[model samples]
Target chain A: MNDKKIKNVFIEGAISSEFIGRSIAKHQTKTSIGAHNIFLGQVRADEVDEKTIYAIEYTAYKDMANAKFHDIREATFKKFDLTCMHIYHSLGTVKVGEICLFVFVSSPRRKQVFKALEYVVEEIKAKVPVYGKEIFEDASHQWKVNS
Target chain B: MNLNIKYFGLLTEVTLCSEETVPFSKATVSELLDLLFEKHPDLKNKDFQVALNNEIVSKDTLITANELALLPPFSGG
Candidate 1:
């Protein structure tokens, strides 16, 4: 993983399928990579108090969140043998059934990518300073907490 | 010194603003919380952690940065 600079992993809205496709296409030249694992987090229309969630408005402590993402990336690289890793998270309103998070990891072996992908995703959920406000169909909202 | 305080997640709903500045003398993190609790008493009941200069600090930690953020539980995936 390019350990040169802190990469901003945030996108304004949903992580579109086109963007994800382009990312995968760009890695074709990395011939040494034998396996790639991807994890996409989609928003669910959960019912709370009988009100269905329509979307989630995501917000973040930007500076700190970016710093935390950088730390997580560094830690994951140290713990796993990965060739490359990329994480993209959505900010602003993401409707239900849309992709909100995308985690991609590549390695020379299948097992490394599988283990690295899970570790990276778990670290992001637990350590990132991003908040999601679950907006219901009635326009009311509640803060989402990771279980 | 003056501290730029940022509120995120549910804390913003209680504070009614995302960012503000509060003047304070040199003190510990808990002292700053007392000042904030006085202004927005509801914040005392909200679950959050204080980050000073992008690093989470304990209440007993001395204030060393001009920037601070109150972050609630993370829900990012």
Candidate 2:
């Protein structure tokens, strides 16, 4: 695996659709990428104990999370043939119906991008030291555990 | 040894602080946790995993570093 720079994946709050659009538009210059696979994780308004979750306050062990993301990136590069990739996740509060995670993978072929995108997202879910606190409508909160 | 322990997410709520330093003679990660659990009984009821020097470790792993973190379940996308 190449010495891919350890990129910081966290953005301050919810990711805007405009930002995501610009990201895709920026990649058009690389015409070699025949397939582009994108994954966006949206915050859901879930109800528990009659309380509806209003937002998620995300936090992370910054150093460890960055290293884990770097490892996942290298592992993905080794497992799939790809042209380029970009991953962004939200830090702080992201309200329900907002975007929290965005992953984009491009390759010359569609099949490789499909497999690679899922692989990266799943690895991120299982490994990275990121946490989310579900803030309810009444201001009560609960810690979120990945299922 | 003087170890710096960090708490994240639910663990922070239990610890009532984000980070702290505790001095101990324990030789393994589990031993230190046992000491911490004794100090903060609330932590004993919380679910978490321990990481030493930025890497998750098993209970039996020896304390090879001074930086430790108590991490709650991950929920990132």
Candidate 3:
């Protein structure tokens, strides 16, 4: 696929449902694939010692985040021979139980699609420069990232 | 000379500010980090990553003037 095939690249204040739905639809058209696997990451309320995580406030260094996302997209294409891939991540603040990241990958067969989707998601989590602030119910917070 | 640096996630909290400028001579990224750590030793043990002009770089990478330095770890989808 051409570079233009990757659309809706953003590290914005927030990611809307419309944007995610459109991304999924865009992949369906690009690939005549029978199967597609999508991974949506949601913020959960967790008890951290004495504090409980009520929500996550996501913040990105915009210029850096965009550059990282672009690099990941190019790398995914080179690593996996697939129909298409689209990645969207939240920027400002995402509350508990809310969606923060949506990764969509499509291919002709279910096996390839599943594997590719997992790889992309794992890479994004490990390499991308996004940060999450876990806010406690009592008003304290902690930054959340992959260990 | 002065260089603008940006901090993210936990680094931001420790520094108490998202961005700041540090006066220094020509130095590598590692050198700059050493100066920063000298001022804020709390960052010495934290898990963080650095970027020079939007690309990830090792701690030993040299940094030039006017480059935006960012310290943030991966948190994408």
Candidate 4:
């Protein structure tokens, strides 16, 4: 496969349904793959004690985030023999129950896809320099970091 | 010499601004943190991860005055 065939870095204020659709279509890949796995992370509204999370204020050190994403893409390529991979992460503010990250990995075999997908998502969550502020309905907030 | 330091997330909130330049001799990132903590004791309570030129660095990594230093936590998606 062409090394440049896959799109792996995306930084946006808000991820749209259209973007996701385009990403999937861009693959246009037909390798008679046994299966494809995808993982979409959506923000959820939650009540923390007296505060109710209404939205998420997403922020990132762009230079660092981009660099980290690129490194991750390279690492993923080294670790997996996959057909293609796509990773999208939101920047700025994202509202509650919205998609923040979309990761899709496809391979000829189902087993590799599943393992690679989980590893990619885990690495992204743990290593990326994106910060999220949980904005409460009452106008109060708290920063969300990896736990 | 002076190093340009960037802040993010909780560190930004505590500092009340994003970036600043601080004078210092050549030192490791941990030493810089010690200096920073001495200047702004409030930061000690928050706990931050340091990065040098966008690459995450351990506390022991040496940092020069010319580099861009960042203190932030892991907050990616």
Best by lDDT: 1
TM-score leader: 1
What TM-score do all the candidates reach, one by one? 0.97, 0.95, 0.85, 0.88
TM-score of the second chain, cand. 3: 0.86
List, residue by residue over A1-147, the lDDT tens digit for candidate 4.
Answer: 234433435566668788888877766666565567888888888779977788787877777676777777778879988877778888777788788888888888888898899999988887777888888998989988676
lDDT of 3 by residue, A1-147 (tens): 235433445555456678778776766456477788888888878788978898777777767666666777787778777777777787767777778888887777788877788887887777667778888989888777565
Off by over 4 Å in 2: A1-3
How does model 4 score by TM-score? 0.88
Question: Whole-model lDDT, candidate 3?
Answer: 0.75
TM-score of 1: 0.97
| Model 4 clashing residue pairs (backbone) | A130-B75
Q: Which structure among the candidates has the greatest DockQ?
A: 1
lDDT of 2 by residue, B38-60 (tens): 88999988788999767899999
Residue A1 miss distance in model 4 (angstroms): 21
Q: Model 3, residue B61: what's the lDDT?
A: 73
Candidate 4 C-alpha lDDT tens digits along B1-77:
88888888888877777888898788898888888888778888986677777777788888853666455666666
When 1 and 2 are scored with DockQ, the better candidate is 1
Error of 2 at A17 (Å): 0.9
User: What do the candidate models score in CA lDDT, each in turn?
Assistant: 0.93, 0.91, 0.75, 0.78
Summarize candidate 1's per-residue lDDT along A74-104 as a digit string, tens digits.
8988999999999999999999999999999
Which CAPRI tier for candidate 2? Answer: high
Error of 2 at B52 (Å): 1.7
B47 in model 2: Cα distance from truth in Å? 2.2
Measure candidate 2: CA RMSD: 1.5
Ranking 2 against 3 by lDDT, winner: 2
